[model samples]
Target: MRYIIVTGTSRGLGEAIATQLLEKGTKLISISRKPNEQLIEKAKYLTIPFDFYSFDLQEIHQIESFMEKIFSNIDVTNVSSIHLINNAGMLAPMKPLERSESEQLIANVHVNLVAPMLLSSAFMKHTKGWNIDKRIINISSGAGQKPYFGWGAYCTTKAGINMLTKCIALEETDKEYPVKVISFAPGVVDTNMQAEIRQTPKEDFIQVERFLTLKENDHLLSPDYVAKAVIELLETNHFDQGGIIRIDEQ
Candidate 1:
């Protein structure tokens, strides 16, 4: 069976991705701060292999051990392929950088960038030469490529993720069994993160009204639609390694 390790599976795109993977009868391991009982029930009802682990990505230091715990269940000898989807992220401390709290800034960076780095590191280190398909998908944002007024922490971390993806791809270029890595920007979706954006004060986010307008006009994409595109790419392995891809372009 193909194995997928996904982060932030409690809701939004992550939840949609996990659900679809279950439907495909793939083995899945999800990481989130808390378990989504509905997903667990669905997996049981479908008799699909699923495992959920409660984890806070902000705990950067514990990430290695955490990954070890999750990887223990996989039987490398029987797996067709292995994938790591770093989907958990946050959009908080919506104020200007000067006014942002130290704790919030640190937490945002930890969750969005640091955790993925360590997780990918651990995954690569543990599965160095398995001679199987290995891929790491980092869920990124357009904000990473453009400057935004109040999204200093979020944008910087996402940009870091893009760079990290490229670096990984470059490092694995000459290896016989290279792990493919890419950053995926899923566009604006109607998720809780968008809600947070809509609720942000105009003074903090100058683009707040634009997002409100998008919501009013039903312009946001659905999580399931975006998840479908992501899963399609994964199932076919039709993606460019080291490239920064956008869902709209897919």
Candidate 2:
């Protein structure tokens, strides 16, 4: 009866996570800009839609209204409910810090960093009234840990996300709440996001050939695999205390 809310479920990693979680038996509340017919057929899924690219998370009011809508949909009387996977994000045509597109830069931070924080906070407030083990896991990237040129906005926002996770972890630990915040890095995968990154201007980004090689070499792990890994990571008791964890390079 664990209620799990996952954002960016329209396709790719988000969709994969939602699907796998459903198969594992959980009450899933999914968020995406568009609905996926396949996800709807899944028994435990309650699909909620939102456009991460267009919606500005800096507009806290908008975020509030959106959360209110979801909260209203939740059957709060239930005894078990808690989990959020803040996975929806954008790479935004990898550009250098200076030459990055202004709109894309802001959108990256808004979706990847700000919105996730807001949604988790809103959910936590809604669920503090419940009895369950609450957990929030952010889908972070390796780009945030090191310099990956052409990954401008993506890197910065993810780095910010890492800090946000730490901040929340500290707060929850101090409050002695059972809630645990996790920031996890999912390594390179064959995703549409990579297609966009490969398109970035040469001067503004990294060499496209290296990316091509990754794709060609079949090094990119399938999204489904990563999703399963997420479930494994969650179950491991390894991070039961909360903090940052990464899906290994495998």
Which whole-number lDDT from 0 to 100 does residue 143 have in model 2? 76
Positional deviation of residue 89's Cα in model 2 after best superposition, in angstroms: 0.5
Worst 10 residues of 2 by lDDT: 47-56
Report the lDDT tens digits of candidate 2 across residue range 1-250.
5667788888889888877776443667777777776877654244433222223345655887788887787666663646888888888747677877787777778888889888978877877646567778888988777777777778788888888888877777756455777888888876888777667677877577787788888898889989988766556566744456677832
Off by over 4 Å in 2: 42-60, 240-242
Lowest summed lDDT across 10 adjacent residues in model 1 is found at 230-239
lDDT of 2 at 186: 83
lDDT of 1 by residue, 100-158 (tens): 99999999999999999999999998889889889999999998899899999999999
Give the TM-score comparing model 1 with the true structure, all chains together.
0.98
- Candidate 1 residue spans exceeding 4 A from truth: none
Cα displacement (Å) at residue 225, model 2: 0.5
| Top lDDT hit | 1
